[model samples]
Target: MMRFDNIIIGMALSLILCGVTIGAERFPPPDFVETDHVIPSPTVPGPRQDIYEYIDAVVLLAALGLSSYLVLRRRSRRAIFVLMVFSLLYFGFWRKGCVCSVGAVQNIVLSIFDRDYTVPITVAVFFLLPLVFALFFGRVFCAAVCPLGAIQDLVLLRPISVPNWLESGLRLFAYVYLAAAVLFAATGSAFVICRYDPFVAFFRLSGNLNILIIGACLLVISVFIGRPYCRFICPYGVLLRQLSRLSKWRVTITPDECIQCRLCEDSCPFGAIKKPTTDWPTTEYSRSKKRLAILILLLPVLMFLCGWASSGLKTVTSRMHATVRLAERIYLEDTGKVEGTTDASLAFRATGKEQKELYADASNIRAEFKLGGWFFGGFVGLVIGLKLIAVSVWRKRTDYEAGRAGCLACGRCFQYCPKEHERLKKIKEARAKY
Candidate 1:
């Protein structure tokens, strides 16, 4: 049965790829007539573009559904791989990677804080659908539907296992990035997440030289790192990891009881599989409890110190907002402290807006950043305190299990279980008898 399924999937993928190639050849690139000393205007999308966005949302939903079925029900890694390829083609190259869930985090934040900013329906769907799926089905989206993860997964050739301590520390960057992206978006500053996306250039086939270089570096690192962006940089992944911990369903190492064979121990490249652990001794347990208590007592102090330090860096954080920078430049240009006026300062002067009013606006934005910094720092401290508490605590596990928060549900471990092979043999025998 598995062989038959593989043949069918292979044929289907071949046909799809061939069809896409023919279609591309049939529709040649349009010719552009360039005029001398003329700058082209940006093209605006029409009603049809809006309809296409809705279509993309529906396609995303369908892809998510099929991915869930493939991972949880069929348990076919080949099917998941084929699906990932299709997603990479359709969502990545074909769509040019617009309306991505990773960047949609900023759009959702801006929509909430800025009343005038409206989020398109497709952006909202792109933002919420994976999270809703994670609530019930774990990170199936990550397994095959997310184009970014799919792209990295394809290039992952020789994945080296990162040390547990180093991996834990690196994962902190994702949380800090999430906090910073939200703060900037809420304060009407720049969307740092979109601006710094390393893979967008690959999707669009054109971008700044620096970003393209970063993308190239990430792909090269992915040859050994195994989805570095998903594991250490994606802000949306942070939310998915938390939601997956509470998911109703999850991927199992085996369909039946464990035989303690340990075959699946080294199967996962991402180091998400957890081994069985014995109970700690009474003395060691007592020491851990004491440490936990001390850490809990110190949590408030950590928060206060972190917040104070963050507030002290307000001048730097406030610079993320354009108005603050503009106000500073205007002040310098007006007071004769600077040499000449910048284009921004010239524009401000031309607007006839009062410098005092601009200063007041910049001050309000700075105040917002000050409060945001406190929350951001407190959030980091809370995460650290929780991590410390988690370390001191222990959970009982008698069998090999996937880490609830760490597993990407990629289905690679399924092939490593001896019981899975036995089950497939049994199915083959049954089919032969029929």
Candidate 2:
């Protein structure tokens, strides 16, 4: 069976690699001469790029299906790891990290808020496929298909477990990131996620120097920490975590059942396993009850305080938008508080537009941020408050179980489970008799 599985993995890898090889040869970079005309933003794919996008979408769908089967049914970490490599090569490097599902999130949000925005069919498919798969098959996308996660997973050499409390606290940043990404995209401020994507420099092979440094740092951290970006920072993973909780199928450490053998306890580098729990002492329960109640009462107050605080950052936050930045630049120039005009200011002047119109547009953008800030900060507070409440509650468990929301479904724990080995042994014996 092991030989059979290896043969299967090898064949699949060959097929994927063959496709990648053909694609690389077929789509050499365009030889356009550089002129003064500004290069168009890739919001919409061109004729050749459109063909690549469709191909990418098809590959994404196939990879997700294969990933789900490998994680949930095969329970083969080796197979999953093989698929992960192909995904990293095809989606991350070969594709140059454009038209990715992660960045497509902003396109979806922009379309939702702006009537004029139209999401490309391929981009829309890229965004929705993994989420739909996640609803049915847990985070198999994270397990073996997401190039970002695959890169981190491959570099994980000496795994260090982050403390669970610290991990939960750190995860709040993802919620904040998601909210901020939505706010910026919705208001045409920016796609901050794509702009600041820490791993993209490595994927595209060239990018902002600071961004490349950041990506390098993250890769270095991944060597010891095991997918820090996926666990603590991925805004898309934040969505996947929630949807995975309601998945119809999920990865389990043991094929049959958990036997509390303790071997698998330390297997997961991500620290996603939850040990069995005993009832809390009555005294502990009483204090916990009081704490829970206090947290519940504080939730509303936290939301209000956070919203007000965020609203106060409207001026700073709104500056992220081009119109707002231009307004400020114009104001500085008019007041003689700074140097000569920039190319942008000169361009605006060239348009013969009145200063008031720019200010009014900036003001409207600021207002949008003001409202968005409230929602963003209020969401942060709400998440924080819920985290506190969740910690205060205790649940009884008799068997070691994977955390539904936290598990990446990487199948790393399977090898440590004696029950899993037993199941495999039985399958081998049955096959031998046949």
Which candidate gets the maximum lDDT versus the true structure? 2
Query: What TM-score, computed on C-alpha atoms, does each candidate reach?
Result: 0.88, 0.88
The residue-level lDDT of candidate 1 at 401 comes to 87
RMSD of 1: 16.6
Candidate 2 residues lying further than 4 Å off, grouped into runs, are 1-49
> What residue pairs clash in candidate 2, if any at all?
none
CA lDDT of every candidate = 0.89, 0.90
Indicate the worst ten consecutive residues by lDDT in candidate 1: 21-30
* lDDT by residue (tens digit), candidate 2, 235-338: 99989999999999988888887778889888899999989997777879778888999999999999989999998999999988999999999999999999
**RMSD in Å for all candidates:** 16.6, 16.3
Q: How would you encode candidate 1's per-residue C-alpha lDDT over 1-434 as one tens digit per residue?
A: 37898887886787686776433454454565773455568998655557888999999999999988988887878999999999989999999787798899999999999999999899999999999999999998899988889889999999899988788889989998999999999999989988998987899999988998998999999999889999998999999999999999988889788898999999888989999998776779778888999999988888888788787788899999999999999888878999988899888887889999999999999999999999888888877777777878888889998898888888899999999888878889999999
Worst lDDT run of 10 residues, candidate 2, spans: 20-29
